[model samples]
Target: MPVSPKIYHGNSTPSPDAELAALIDAHPKPSSLSEYSYGTAGFRYEASLLPCVFVRMGIFAALRSASLGGEEVGAMITASHNAEPDNGMKLADSHGGMLDAAWEEHAVSLANAPDSQHALALIHTLLSQHTSTGDGGNSSKKKLPKMVVHIGRDTRSHSLPLAALVIRASRAMGATVIDHGEVTTPQLHHFVMHANGHMLPSIIPQRCNESGYCEIMAMSYAALLRTGSVGGKGNVGKQRLHSTSTLVIDGACGIGALKINQFQHIFEKLRAEGCTVGLPTLHTVNFPGDGPLNDKCGAEYVQKQQLPPRLYTPSSKGAVSKRYMTSFDGDADRIVFHFEDEAGKFHLLDGDKIAVLVSSFIQDELRCIDPEGKAVKCGVVQTAYANGSSTLYLKNVVKTNVVIAKTGVKFVHAAAHHHFDVGVYFEANGHGTVLFGPKFYDFISAADAKLRGTSRHNRANIALRRLRVLPALVNQSVGDAMSDMMLVDAILFLRGWDLSTWSKLYSDMPSKQAKVKVADRSIITTNENETAAVAPAALQIALQAAMDDMISQESSGNGPKPRCFVRPSGTEDAVRVYAEANTQKGADTLAYEAMMLIYKLCGGVGAPPQPLITNRL
Candidate 1:
């Protein structure tokens, strides 16, 4: 057996043990809640269990920071897409990106520590394991690195106390801590990315909010400056919005709602500061402080159900299908945009759609930016969750390179970095962003500077300007619904198109997702790409037969364009099945077939899977 290294702060002040002890004691006689395994997000469970997790995470954050030469590690205290009572915490790397995959086990280890004392000991072990004294051996003299941690949270009522626990725990460890109160997940990420470089965030309250808006807005405004309706030159007399141009926002009554309100205030301030383009008039709904968050209204609900949230019922008045509408998840990390048709049909533009459209636009810009045909190639990365038609369209139609990765942002982000001028990644759930490699940004900067003296009147010049500003406008730190909304808006406005026009880009096959309780989800392993299963070897064989059957059933050009796959969920104790077909009936039949087969093989906790059919939107 190996020996444990000495435990002490390397170069910081002494630990605040009294505070740590009191905090550990104050959280209440720790209820012996069910065990929790760190999932795609870090530690998540009911808010009650999160205090203990937060305690361990505080130390984990400090260790992470110290290991990175005292760089500030980011911690966010919001459970995105989960119900209101659920809360989770995840660490950001030194520069405001997702937590490194290699280091995740250490966190999960710390989370699994049986009690405070065990977690405390694990912290020291983590420090020793990660510390390098610029020497070759792990012999002796290793010590804790200096630590700095930054914390932020959403508007969850339960999150505040959890946030406080993180604060106290970090303080107890003698790490430098900064509390940026009540920010969306993206805002926290942006702050981390900005603070890591010369892009320091404003320390002031109102100014911080205003400055944050300006950073993304500055880029967006420049891009849209040529539009007269946006206060530029052409169509100068056109109102900011007509009937369809007006936006109705469903915030999911979460942090996104509050930020939308805050952004509206910042827009006014920006207008006062000589910004020309007007912020679109927004009708905010489902804002936080109004009701339970993510209860029944959010991107998750809209996308999965293929319908608008209950609160978002179409009015009898305006053009129901024409107006643009969007929804954000509980913590504002995911978004799905939709609109109803004149015939009261609903259309969803999910992450797959966003990836295709956004990447295509960027690809077009790259061609024009280097019009000499030097070929600044861009590409897309997606998960198995991406629609099959989307993957095909991207590979064949868009002509951009396409790569598939596992089901998390870190994996996709890494894959996108390997070979592309720009990489766009998104889950079907609407969590994703466009990444511009350093060389790409440098190329854009050079192109913009080269065109500095040219007239901005030409549409080509305007497009180039938008490309230049896009690097800044994109929240490359993470997938931000707000930033993405702005990007989609800019693209639609630039193209002079509406949802109807965008919908015409490609039609989504009718798809369905189902969840089945499983006795041992762990046994349901996935293939490397997570597109198919690895265990119960016969499962794959069965799925193929089901596809063949579905295809045979629809052989005459009306059959299901059958696609089906099943995998165990990382966060929940269930297996998820996905199916898509050219027709609603086909999709339903495919989903039902897949579900029934999985339940038969995988110890499902219900009556045999029943056929679930809904009118496809």
Candidate 2:
């Protein structure tokens, strides 16, 4: 039985210490299981094992907010591409990014406490650290600032109950919790960042609500469309705006679909008032209840299989005449675009393509704004998983500096923030965002002020206006499918380019990704960039020999040579092998061979993995 809060600290309000003890007693970790460690995202497991974890995390979120002097922190309940039975939670720091690395260890300690006594002790120790200390005085007497936690959830059936646990635990710790129910992951991030004063209301133009997200997106998009391109680049008139077929979005049958529908309604409302230009019609498929989330659709499916979603199969009746389509993951934080060529073959424009295109456009804009390259510096951050062709094009063709970061969005986000004036980062899996440094924003503001003297039709004036509104068009705190789609559309309209034109900019070398189940995935490790395996010397040696053999076999190919790497997956119980080659067959063979090698070398779980069957002509 759970202890009532009123029973502790006397009267109605319980003391923090007493309340914490009661909460810990109410939710205890299983002694039979090993300690849960926070991973690349956060705590994830079967929904059945998470109720206790949520309570502890909720209390920790409150502690984090108090530690930050009452700055708003966020707790989002989502699995993000995982099956419905599996759910997870990730905490956002005051800046609205992933939890700070320094505190991840503390999170582990709190979640792994053996019993209620140990848990209470850990909480007390953490609480003492956050209190003021002076002249050997007792720190426990000092009162901490009021803590605030912003909570959001996805459409998972278990998500609401889990969110309720978080809210209850947070309030028990004497923190105020604001519940934003059924929001996309990025929307919650946007709310926290906006509430904490990181983004200017004048620039973003949103009030931190569902409607606010749409308002800011619509406003920025309209601003960009109204400003004609400089030089001979075409302006976005009515015809150019709708030149392409209706954009069909595969929503992965999750919360993103609902959010897209809401955005569409908002767009239509704004269109009627003439506050926005008419753009291509957005038709969303696989909405909630259309099917189980991410069964055979979503960005992950399209990017890995290199096929259209199940609903948009080549022979399916739902296939549109449009040359382009896009898909959003469960929570709408990631997006990827795909299209069919004249031969009815599918082509995916994964995150690598998005990074190249966006960076290239920004590069051109910066050069146009200042040919001397003095105002801003542009750089792109990619993971080892990035297609080699994309890296080559970015370096040789885009004429920009490219840096490699370890896998995961946090690392890339950090690298982009530290490396350049305008940092563009994206994973090949379609999770990405653009970050504009303070210096870049300052430059744009100064340019806009200087161009005030010229007519709005001046090329420089138009370019400056577009630059000024670009940041608002992006969800700077995180990757947002809605924001990213708008940015891509605006750029395409400005450059007078279409899907085929974008695809022709650069070609992707064929690549394959496969995973092998292992008894213990942690036994495998890799270098900082994750391009090569480091641990289990025998495994590394075997992988190297395999990669060497494949490269030697493809040395005389027409395109890029073969490259391969095997790394342990952060979110699963398997080691993932990725191989790239000049031809699709070579890539597939290398991937299959490597997977089998890992399974044989390491402890094999079930049957050995099998290669996927492709029916493409």
- Cand. 1 Cα-lDDT: 0.72
Clash totals in order: 2, 0
- Model 1, 1-617: lDDT tens per residue? 11111122322334443455556555533558656577776777778777777876776787788788778777899988888788998678866688887888888877666665666556656656676633331213343456777788888888888887787677666677777777778777776676566433222112123255444654454345345343233333233445345667788888887777655665566667766453565566777766678877889888888778756433532332236888889878888888887787888889999998899888776665575535465889988778878887887888878888988877887888776768898888888888777677667667777778877655456556667667667776788888888787766666556777887887777788888888888879889888788897888889989888887776636322678889998877689988887778888888888888778888888678888868755
Task: Count clashing pairs, candidate 2.
Answer: 0
Writing each residue's lDDT as its tens digit, candidate 2 over 1-617 gives 11111111111253555766677777777655576868888898888878778888888887788778789889999998888898999888878788889888888888888766777677667776764423222224455567888898989999999998888888777678888888889988887887788445355554566677677877788777666433444464544634353788888888888887766776677778875553667778878787888878998877777778866333342545547689998888889998887888887899999999999988887776788877798899999999999998999899888999999888999999999999999899899989988889788878877777887766666777788888888888888888898888878877767788898897898888888999999888899999887887787788777778878877745455688888998866799989888778888888888888888887769998897544552
Candidate 1 error regions (>4 Å): 1-34, 132-145, 198-210, 213-215, 225-244, 269-278, 312-322, 372-374, 449-452, 458-460, 556-560
Q: Which pairs clash inside model 2?
A: none
What residue runs in model 2 are displaced by over 4 Å at the alpha carbon?
Answer: 1-12, 30-32, 133-142, 198-202, 229-237, 241-245, 275-278, 312-322, 556-559, 608-617
lDDT (Cα, 0-100) at 395 in candidate 1: 79
Q: Which ten residues in a row have the lowest lDDT in candidate 2?
A: 1-10
Model 2 RMSD in Å is 4.5
Instruction: TM-score for candidate 2, please give it.
Output: 0.92
